[model samples]
Target: MSAPNSLKDVYLDEMKDLWSANDQMTRAVKQLGEKVSDPKLKQMLEHSVGGIEKHTGVLKQLIEAAGGQAEPEHCKGMEGLVTEALKHGIKEASSDGKLQDVAIIAQYQRMSHYGLAGFGSAAAYAKVLGMSDAETKLKQAVSEIYKGDEYASKLAEAVEQAAA
Candidate 1:
């Protein structure tokens, strides 16, 4: 894609990046879920997978609404995060199930926070462009991402307590 020359173009670029990020996150979360031993943590990751799918659809709609093709650009940031997550959450914590759960929760939050920032920014851009529908959708996505993040935080507390 060419350099974004307008606000709408920038919004499109952001949507593409977010689409890629969400796709990568969904895959990583599923892999993490498979490795997690705790039932509650596993369930949380499973639920998040659905939300991530819905959010990706929303991003596609928003991209079309903005008059852009819904093709995802490679999200290198998410790629790096996922790499680290797999290395530490799965690879490094193989010997300790509890520690693996803790690592997954931490990595999940890091990814969720990234999603929050992207959705928040996209919503703001939509609002600035006077695209109320896009803004509302993006805001809803942000809320969903936040719920996952909050769940991870609670899970982290539980994991820490278990470790103590």
Candidate 2:
């Protein structure tokens, strides 16, 4: 996308970038889910795929609502995070189930945090532009992401304790 001359452009661009980010994250989460030994971790990852898809839909809606094409511009930031997730959570993952679970949660949270930042920023932009509907949806997505991140943190703690 070209440089944004207005807040609307930035907001739309953020939504488009989030679309690509969600798509990339969905694939990575699925791959991570398949590799996880912990049933709880696996379940969370599976559930998150659906959540990510829903958020992707919201992003599409927001982009179109703002009179922008829903087409996603590839997010280089998410691309890097996904690469790191695969490398650490899968490629160099430990043989120990508990250790691998820790790595997976860490990777998942890293990606989720990026989403939180993007979605939160988009929501702020929407609020500044007086688009209450857009702001509400974006904020909702951020809240959901935060919930997942919190769950992952708790799960990580449980896994670490179990390994001790």
Candidate 3:
């Protein structure tokens, strides 16, 4: 596709990026769940996969509504985040479950923050373009991501105490 020339175009690009990010996160969280030994953290990660799938579907619908193809543009930012997460949260912390849980929480927050920013931006663009329905959906996705991030933060506190 070409460079975004209008607010609608920008919104479509944001949706595509989010779609890719959610796809990557779904896989990353599943793999991280397998590596984590903390029952609570494992369960949270498992639940996150479902949320990511739902958000991805929402993004696809938004893209189609905007007259854009419902396909993902590669999200290099998410790719980098996932790679680093696997290395630090899984491979490097293999011997320590508590530490792995901590790493996973940190990595999860980083990715969630990215999603928050992307969805927030998309919602703003949607508002500017008078696309109220798209804006509402994007805001809903942001709320869900924020809740997950808050949960991860609580888990991080528990993991920290355990590690100490």
Kindly report which residue pairs in candidate 3 clash with one another.
Answer: none
lDDT of 1 at 164: 60
Q: What is the C-alpha lDDT of each candidate?
A: 0.90, 0.95, 0.90
Q: List, residue by residue over 1-164, the lDDT tens digit for candidate 2.
A: 79999999999998999999999999999999989988999999999999999999999988988999979999999999999999999999999988998999999999999999999999999999999999999999999999999999999999999877
Tens digit per residue, CA lDDT, model 1, 48-80: 999999999999988987789869999999999
What is the alpha-carbon lDDT of model 2 when measured against the actual structure?
0.95
TM-score of each: 0.97, 0.98, 0.97
What digit string (tens of lDDT, one per residue) describes model 3 on residues 1-164?
69878878888888898999999988998888998888999999999999999999999888888899989999999999999988888888758789878888898888889899999999999999999999999899999989988888998999999988
TM-score, prediction 1: 0.97
- Largest TM-score belongs to which candidate? 2
| Candidate 2 error regions (>4 Å) | none
* The 10-residue segment with the lowest total lDDT in model 3: 91-100
Residue 158, candidate 3: alpha-carbon lDDT: 92
Which residue pairs clash in candidate 2? Answer: none
Clash number by candidate, in order: 0, 0, 0
Give me candidate 3's TM-score against the actual structure: 0.97
